[model samples]
Target: MIRHLVLFKLNEGVSRDEERVVAGVKAFQELDGVVPELTFWECAWNITDRPIAHDFAINSAVADRDALTRYLEHPAHQAAAARWREFATWVIADYEF
Candidate 1:
């Protein structure tokens, strides 16, 4: 399987309670069942207070590179990601396990 991880940092002055941010989180939270290529999906807000910690994260897996590609290209995933773009920036990493 391929593990796909994403870490997000909210834009300066952006609050998690903002309407758009809440909607973005809700959108991602619903992706697991909506994206057929996802073998696993988990996402949440960061609980740590450390400066180095990201504000949000997504931990997910797929069967292989092809499945990972399908997940990335899926319309629901694309739409959720687009919503996050309005309030945050993120980094991603993928590795086979």
Candidate 2:
């Protein structure tokens, strides 16, 4: 399986409480049902206030690299990512399990 993990940092002046950010997070949270390739999905706001911590995170799993690619290419995922791109930057890591 491929575990796809991401950490998101909100841009300056952006807050997780903002309606747009909330909706963006919801969009990502809903991806488990939208993308067939995704076998697992978990997304949430970060509760920690440490300077090194990000504002949000996504932890997902897929069967393989091909499934991961499909998940990435899925339209719903693309739309959610575009919305987040406006207010946040992210880093990701994929690992096999």
Candidate 3:
């Protein structure tokens, strides 16, 4: 199995309550049932105010590297990411379990 993690930090001056950010969050939250390659999916906002913390996170799993690739390349995933591109930057990590 592969664990795919992503952490997102909103761009300076962007707020979570903004229309675009709200829409972006909803888009990602709706991906669980929309993407077939996802064996597991969890996404949510960060709870802490620590300086080192990211504003949002995605913790998901797939059957394998190929599955991970498909999940990453899926059109729905791409579109959701594109929306975030307008207000946030993110980092990702993938590894075998």
Candidate 4:
């Protein structure tokens, strides 16, 4: 399996609450339904007083390299990227075995 993780820095005008960010991340559940290769997806955000993560981070598990490739090029992913690009300053992603 491939473990995919990403940390994001949100744009200046975007809100930075943990629950709201988690809600946004939960939206990936829908993508999993549409894109079969994604075995798991989850995200969390930093808190106001207690930062749980750096900015925003996503953790996903996929079947293999091909599955990861499929997830990356999927239309559902593109839509998700477009949604995130609107309020993200920058994003860092990594994949592991």
Candidate 5:
């Protein structure tokens, strides 16, 4: 399986509770039902106050690289990512499990 993890940092002045941010989060949360390639999906806001901690995270798994690709290309994921791009930057790590 491929484990796909991501940490998102909100842009300066962007609040996690902002309407658009909340909607974007919801969009990602809704992806598990829409993407067939996903074997696992978990996402949440981070509560830590540490400087190195990101504002949110996503932990997901798929069968392999191809499945991961399909998940990335899914319309719902693209839409959610685009929304996030307006107010945040993210880092991702993908590894075989």
Candidate 6:
């Protein structure tokens, strides 16, 4: 099995207001394909003073590597990604167990 995890940070000068962020989050949930088993989260913790730190802020767990690749290549995901690119930093990792 494969495990795909991701994290995101909104841009320094472009913090999304709570409402917009929530909307975006929901929009992501509504994506129609390339996701089989998935989960997401939004950050609510204060972690501004730590180094080597990345809270699992804005995360998704894809069920497998194929899903991860398909998710990235999906048209709907591409649209959302274009929007996110302007105001986000992201990390993705894949693991096997």
lDDT agreement with native, every candidate:
0.96, 0.94, 0.97, 0.71, 0.95, 0.57
Q: Which 10 successive residues of model 5 have the least lDDT summed?
A: 26-35
Count steric clashes of candidate 3: 0
Pairs of colliding residues, candidate 6: none
User: In angstroms, how far off is 10's CA in candidate 3?
Assistant: 0.3
lDDT of 3 by residue, 25-64 (tens): 9999999999999999999999999999999999999999
Best by lDDT: 3
Residue 56 in model 6: lDDT: 28
Query: Per-residue alpha-carbon lDDT of model 2 for 23-90, expressed as tens digits?
Result: 99989988978899988899998999999999999999999999999999999999999999999999
* Candidate 6 segments whose C-alpha is farther than 4 A from its true place: 18-22, 32-63
State, as a TM-score between 0 and 1, how close model 5 is to the true structure.
Answer: 0.98
Q: Count the backbone clashes (under 3 Å) in each candidate.
A: 0, 0, 0, 0, 0, 0
State candidate 6's TM-score: 0.59
Q: Which ranking of candidates, highest lDDT first?
A: 3, 1, 5, 2, 4, 6
Q: Please, what are the lDDT tens digits per residue for candidate 6 over residues 1-97?
A: 5555556676666555656555555556566334444443233423565655553244455656676677678777777667666666778777764
lDDT of 2 at 8: 97
Kindly list the per-residue Cα lDDT of model 4 for residues 1-97, writing each as its tens digit.
8888777777666775545445556565467568888788776665554543457767888998898888889987877777677667555555666
| Off by more than 4 A, model 3 | none
Q: Kindly report which residue pairs in candidate 5 clash with one another.
A: none
- All predictions: root-mean-square deviation over Cα? 0.5, 0.7, 0.5, 3.7, 0.5, 4.1
Show model 2 residue runs off by greater than 4 Å: none
lDDT of 5 by residue, 1-73 (tens): 9999999999999998899999999999999779999999999999889999999999999999999999999
Residue 49 in candidate 4 has what lDDT? Answer: 43
